[model samples]
Each structure stands twice: as structure tokens, then as C-alpha cells.
Target: MRKIIVIGSMSIDLVVSSSKRPEKGETILGDNFFTTPGGKGANQAVAAARLGEQVYLVGRIGDDDFGKEIYENLKDNNVLVDGVEPVTQMPSGTAHITIADQDNSIIVVPSANNEVTIEYVKKHLEQLDSGDIVLLQQEIPSETVAFAIEYCDRNGMISILNPAPYREVSNQVIESATYITPNETESNAMFKGNMEDALQAYPKKLIVTMGDKGAIYHDGNRKVTVDGYKREVKDTTGAGDTFNGAFAVGLQKEYDIEKAIAFANLAASHSVTGMGAQGGMPTLLDLEGEWHV
Candidate 1:
């Protein structure tokens, strides 16, 4: 199996549950509060590792308790953490999350995560073999994200760019990436005007994930929509990351585009069934053996 390398951030997620969002300058009693190991890169690594992939996470954590827990969480999930480093005198990154009315709002504090610069990432990239899948997100610097895509393009590696938390990305990077997975809102920000036009513009390369509606991509011949599975949603925070990770595993297995998206959607459906980002991710065994294609 091909190794999946996730390059981005490592942080702890502080989550709170409430009946509704408070108004400006208003305070309300929340139902519950908890902390979990999270961050886009860590979540994807755990998701892929849970699905039995040989995954490696490359990023920065802080020299703090949160960082230690994050590292152990990755190890516990069977992810290779040799590329993960701790930045001195920096606190671990964190996402302040509020789960209200079945939806979540997040405020990210990027501390040590900001230390994942291109210089640091290139060192890890040099150690990886060509043809490996390099998964990336917006949690790190935009310049590093762009550089990784170019590096993957030059090295014959497959690049999956999940343009989350919405940021402006260059067209060159978009064109060079093997796949671009963006959610509904993100796709809207990436390509203005018509959605179909955007999908057609990149063919199978641009995958737009619609929450509960599944994901859609243009096959260069026609548009294909992979339907999502219905499940009891306890938390939707990790659904997108689950999809991205599962999709990478599908690609590593050489599944066709439709099959890959279907597998990803299935995994994502299972993700929303539990709380926290990594909590609900399905293991290879949990897929009822459907992973064998």
C-alpha cells in the first residue's frame, strides 16, 4: 500500500455543547465541555490510520501537555509520527469549538502550527518517496500549501489538497494538484458563479463535497454524484476530514474515481455518528469488509 503523508497542523480541540448560539455580548450556560486531540493533519492521519493505511503525519506541536497528548494520540491510532516535531517556547495550537443546534462553529488559535513552514516541510518531504500521496489542508501557511503542491507535481507524487477553512489559492497550485476536495461553502469561495462550471473546469480533479448530499465530480465525460449514507449524526466536525482521508486510502488502493468517492462518503457517514473529530472515524474492520475492492 502507498504511504499517505499528511502535512498540516496538530492541536487540541476544546468543544462545548449548547442549545443555541449566543447573541453579541450575551452569555448563556452551555450543556457540556470537553477536550480532544484534533487538528486537520492529525485528524486525517488518524482517519487514514484507522482505515488500515500506513500513514505519516508531518507538522508541529508545542512543548506543552496538549502536544504530548497529540503525539500519543497519533501513535495510539497507529500513525507514524517521526515527522512530527515540537516547537520550543510555543503553545500547542487549539480550536475553540461550539456545537449548537446540530452545527459547529470553530475559532482556531494557530501557535506552534504556524511553525510548519516550507523549510520544515521540505525536510520531511525529502525523506518521503515519490508516488506517495501527500495530503494537505489550510491549517498551515498558504505558501507552504502551495509549495507542497508544486513539490508533489515535480516529484511525481499524488497531491490531495483539501481547501478548508477557505483561503485564496493560486490557479497554478489548483491545476497542479491531483485532487481538490472542498466542501459546499469552500467550493463557493474557490470558484464563484456556477458550481457545475467549476466541476467541469477541472473534470475529476475537483471534488465538491456536499454535506449529507454526498460528493460530486465531473468525469471529463459527465458529472457524477456519489450519494451520502444516512446516519445518526452526533457530531459533524470531522466528516470532511474523514472523507479526505478515506479518499486518499481509496486512491492508494487504485480504486476508480466513483468508487473512491463512494468509499469516502461511506466513511464520512460513519464519522458523524460519534463525538469529536477522531472519535467516530470507522476502522477497516468497521467497514463490514466493504473496503476490499
Candidate 2:
């Protein structure tokens, strides 16, 4: 299997379960609260590792308790942390999440995560071999993401970009990526039009993930839709990350794009059956031996 490198944010997620969100200027009681090690990068790394991939996580964390906890969480999941750095002056990143009716609202405070620089990513690229898979998300600096995409292009590696939390990305970054995985909202933000146009623009490189509608893959000339699996959803968090991680593993294993998306869809559906991000992600064994192509 090819090595997978995940570059993005690492955070401590404070998750609360409530019947409804409190209106402005009103405080409401919550059903439950729990702390989990999360962040897009860490979640993807853990997802991939659980699926039997050799994964390395690259991101920045603070020298605080949250940072320590997140680091240990990654280590415990068998994700390599050689590329992780600790920023002494800042606190670790954090996300305040609320889940209601199986939907979620999140507010992220990117502290040390903002400290991940282009230089840091470049340095870590030295540890990757040619043809290795590099997975990235929008939780970190866009400039660093752009640089990493271009660097991977120059190094003959496959670069997959997951534009989550929706932000404006440069054309250079878009074109540099070998694959761009974006959900409906992100696709709209990036292309400013319908999903078809986005796929037309990026061709096979653009993968649009539609929550329960499954995913669509366009190869410029043709479009294919992969239906999502049916499952009881407890929480929707980390489902996309799970899909992306599984997709990367499928690619690393040389599966065709359609097969890869199928694998991803199944993995993502399984993820929603549990609560929390990393906690809900399914392992290869959990796939009931159906993960194989």
C-alpha cells in the first residue's frame, strides 16, 4: 500500500447534544457533553489508519493539555506524528459542536492550527516517497495547501484536496490538485454554479459528495453516480472525512475511481451510525470484509 499523508488541523472537539439550539440571548440546557480528539486532519488520519492504511498526520498543535491529548489520540490510533509540531505560544485548536436531530453546528477556533506554514509542509514532504498519496483539507492555511498541492504535482505524487468548511481557494490550488473532493456547499462555493458545471470544470478530478444522495464523479465526458448506503445516523460529523480517507486508501490500492467512491460511500455511511467524529469511524473489520474490491 502507498503511504498516506494528511495535512490540516488538529483540535479538541467539545460536543454537546441538545434538543434545539438556543436562540441569541437565551441559554438552554443540553442533553450531554463530551470531549473528543478531532480536527479534519486527525480525523482523516485516524479513518485511514483504521481502514488498514499506513498514515502520517501533519499539522500544528499547542503545548497545552488539549494538544497533548490530541497527540496521544493520534498515536493511539497508529497514525504517525513525525510531521506534527507544537506551538508554545498558543493554545491548541478547538471546535464547539452542537448536535440536534442528527445535524450539527460547529464553531472552530483555529489557534496553533494557523501556525502550520508552507515551510513546515515542505519539510515533511521530504519524508514521503514518489507516488505517495497526500491528502489535504481546508482547516489549515490555504497558502500552505496550495504550496503542498504544487509540490506534490512536481514530485509525481497523487494529491487529493478536500475543500471543507468552505473557503475561497486560488485557481492555482484548484488546478494543482490531482483530485478535488467537495461537498454540495463547497462545490457551489468553488464553482459558483451547479454541480454539473463544477464537474465539467474539473472533469474526473472533481468529486461532489452529496450527503445522503451519495457522490457524483465526472470525467469531463461522462458522469457516474454512486448511491449512498443506508444506515441509522447518530451523528453526521466526520462522515465526509471518513469518505475521503477511504477514497484515498482505495486509490492507493489502485482501485478504479468508481470502486473507490463506492468504498468511500460505505465507509461514510457506517461512520454516521455512531456519535462523535473519530469515535464513529469504522475499521476494515467493521466493514464486514466487504471493503475488498
Candidate 3:
């Protein structure tokens, strides 16, 4: 079995929901407040693990209660945490999220996540080999992301780069990554608003995820759009992470691009029907009847 290695951040989420967004300098009542284990990297790890993949999460957490909870959550989800460690004296990473109108806005404090340095990754890199499925996100240092992509290329590993939270991506990184997944906004920013051109430029390599509508990728022959499964929306926080994780599993199963995206779409649709990012993630058994693979 190919190992799924996720190099990213781990954090706790402080979430609040309201019917409307607060204007500047104004305070408003909210519907609910909660905390859950989340972070782009952790969410994807859990998502993949829930789908029955043996996922290894590599990142840093703080030596705090929140960090302990995050660690426990990963273990509960069956994600291997050999690469996850706590940084003494540092605060655990956190995302303060506000949900309004079924959508969300988040403010992240990368605390200990910033400790995922190149040196740290090098210490763990020796364990990886060719054919491993390495999933990554932009929650860690930018240099680490670039190095990992290049390393995967050199080692013959497959790398899926999820550029979230909007960072300025470099051309070399884009070219080096085996797969680059970004949402509509992030894709536009990545390619200077030339989505069609960008898709054509990297057929089969660039996947743009659109919420609810679906995701699209160029097939080298033509543009293929995988329609998303419709589900009642509760919270959309980890829907994209769910998609990335499920997509990685799909690839591990040797499914074609279309099938993989379809599988991811189904999983993402299920993800939004619940509250926390990992709350509604479906197990492989949950996908029995609907998932073709």
C-alpha cells in the first residue's frame, strides 16, 4: 500500500456562527460558539484516514492542552503522528472562524506551525520513498512547501499541493508540483485571473475546485468538470480539505482523474452537512453504494 504523507500544520479551531457578518467596530450576537481540532493539514489527514487510508501527518503543535487535543484527535482518526511533535514554549496554532450565511471567514495564528522548518522536514524526509502519496498545504513555511515539491519530483513521489489561505505561489513551485489544487479565487490569483489559460497550460496537473458547483481540470484533450454532489449546507469550513484528502485516496486506488474528482466531490458534499471540519467526513463504508470505486 502506498503511504499517504501529509506535511502541514495542526491547530484548534475557535468557531462562531451568526446570521450576518459584523460591520467594522460593531458587535453582534452569534448563534453558537465551539472549538474543534482543525488545521488544513490535520483536517486533510483526518479526512483521508476516515476514508480508510493510513495517513501520516507531519507538522508541529504547541505544548499545550489544545495541542494535546489536536494530537488525540489525529490518533482517534487513525492518522499516524510519528512526524507530529510539540514545540515547547510555543502556543498551538489556531484558526478563529466566523460562519455567516453558510460560508466562513477565518483568521489563523500560525504559532507553532511556523516551526515546521526545512530542517525539521529533512529529519522526516528520509522515511519517504518513491510512489508515496504526499499531500501538502500552505499552512507551513513557504520555503518548506517549495522544498517538498522539489523533493517529491526528485524522489519520484507524487505530490498534491493544496494552495489555500491565499499565498503568492511561484512559477517553479507550480511546475514542480504533480498536482496543484486551488479554489476559484486562489486559482485566479495563481494565474492572474486567466483560469482557462491556466487550465490549458497545465492540463491534468491543475485542478480548480468550485464550491457546490464542482471542480474542473483540463484533461490534455479537453476541460473536464466533475459536478459536485448536492447536499444541505451546514458549515463549509473543511469541505475543501475533505476534497483533497478524498482525491488523494482516489489516486491511490488508481482511479482515473474523472473518477477521483467525483469521489472527492461526493466526500466534500457529505462534509458540509455537519458542523466541524472532520465531523461529517465519511468512512469508506459510508461511500459504499454511491462511490463507484
Candidate 4:
């Protein structure tokens, strides 16, 4: 199987659960509080690794306790951390998350994650061979993300770009991706139209995810919708990341687009039944008897 190379952010996630969100200048008691390793990049890397893929994560962390935790977490999941660097000047990245009624709101502080430069990405990507799958996210610098995609394109690697926390991305970046996965809101932001129109515009190049409604993809000739598995959602934080990781793994295993998307949908659906980002990802063992392509 081809290796899955992830270029993205790593952070410690501080999460709290409450009955309801507080109003302006209001303080309320929360039900629970916890910490976990998170970040779009790290979450996806762990998801892919747990699914039985050989994975490598390239990012930056701080020389703090949180950074140590992040490193150990990645290592524990069997993701290679040789490309991960520690910077002394900045604290590790962190996300403050609030969950209410199964929905979540997040605030991120991009500390050492800001140090993921184009130079840094290039240095790590140079070690990867062609035919590897390169996964990217927006939590790091946009320029670095763009560069990584372009580099992967130039080198014959399959580059998958997941545009989360949606932002303006260059056409060059968009054009360079082998596939682009975006949720409904992100697709609306990028294409300036409804989901139907966006799907029509980039039929073969885009995968638009609709939570619980499943996902839609066009294989150049026709558009197909894969139904999501029904599950009681406990938290939806890392569902999309799970889908992306599973989708990449399917591609690495040479599954057809439809089969890959179906596999991804199931993985994502299973993810929401658990808590936190990385914590919810299902392993090969978890899916052994249930999932088959």
C-alpha cells in the first residue's frame, strides 16, 4: 500500500460540555471538562494510522508539556513523527471547544502550528516517494498548504486537500489537488452557490459532505450520493477528519471512488458516536466484522 503523508497542525484540545451556551457576559456551570490531542492534521493522521495505513505526520509543536503530549499521542497511534519539529519560542497549539446538544464550537490558538512554513513542508515532502497520498488541511499556513499541494501535483503524488475552517484559497492550489473534500458550508464559501451548483461546477474534483445526509461525489460522468450510516451522535468534532482519512486509505488501497466514499461515510458515521476528535476514530479492529468493500 502507498504511504499516507499528512501535512498539518498538532494541538492539545481543551473541551467542555454544558447544557446550553451562555449569553454575552454570562457565566454558567459546565457538565464536564477534558483534554485530548487534536488538530485537523493530527486527527486525520491518527485516523488513517488507526485504519491500518502506514502514516507520517509533518508539523510543528512547542517545547511545552502539551507538545510532549501531542508527540506521545502520535507515536502511540503508530504515526511517524520524524518530520515533527519542536520550536522553543512558541507554546504548543491549542483548541478550546464547547459542546452542547451534540454540536460544538471551537476557538483555536495557532501557536507553534504557525511555524509550519513552506520550507518546512518542502523538507518533509522531499522524502516521500511518488504514488504516496498527501493529505492537507487549513489549520496551518495557507501558503504552506498551497505549496504542499502544488509540490505533490508536480511529483505525481495524489494530493487530497480538505478545506476546513473555510478560507480563500488560490486557484492554483485548488487546481493542484487530486481531490478536494469540503462540507456543505465550505463548498458554499468556495463556489458561491448552493450544493447542487457546486457539485455541477466541479463534478469530478470535489466531494461535498453533508452530515448525516451522507456525501456526494461526481466521477466526471455522473454524480453519486453515498448514504451515511445511522448512529446516535455524541460529538461531531472529528467526523470530517475521519472521513478524509478513511477516504485516503481507500484510495491508497485502490478502491473505486464510490466504494471509497462509502467506506469513508461509514467511518465518519461511526466517529460521531464517540467523544472528542482523535478519541472517536475507529480502528480496523472496530470495523473488522461490520465493514466490507
- lDDT at residue 73 of model 4 (Cα atoms): 97
Each prediction's total of clashing residue pairs, residues at least 3 apart in sequence or on different chains, is: 0, 0, 0, 0
Worst 10 residues of 4 by lDDT: 195-204
The C-alpha RMSD in Å for every predicted model, in order, reads 1.0, 1.1, 0.8, 1.1
lDDT of each: 0.92, 0.91, 0.92, 0.91
Per-residue lDDT of candidate 4, residues 184-292 (tens digit): 8899898876777667667667999898889998766678899888898899999999999999998988988788888888889889989999877998888878787
Which candidate tops lDDT?
3
For model 1, residues 162-229, the per-residue Cα lDDT tens digits are 99888999999998999999998999888984778999999989999997899999999999999988
Among these predictions, the greatest TM-score belongs to 3
Model 2 residue 206 CA deviation in Å: 0.3
Q: Model 2 clash tally?
A: 0
Candidate 3 deviation (Cα RMSD): 0.8
What's the C-alpha lDDT at position 45 in model 4? 94
lDDT of 2: 0.91
RMSD of 4: 1.1
Report model 4's TM-score to 2 decimal places: 0.97
As for candidate 1, its clashing pairs are none
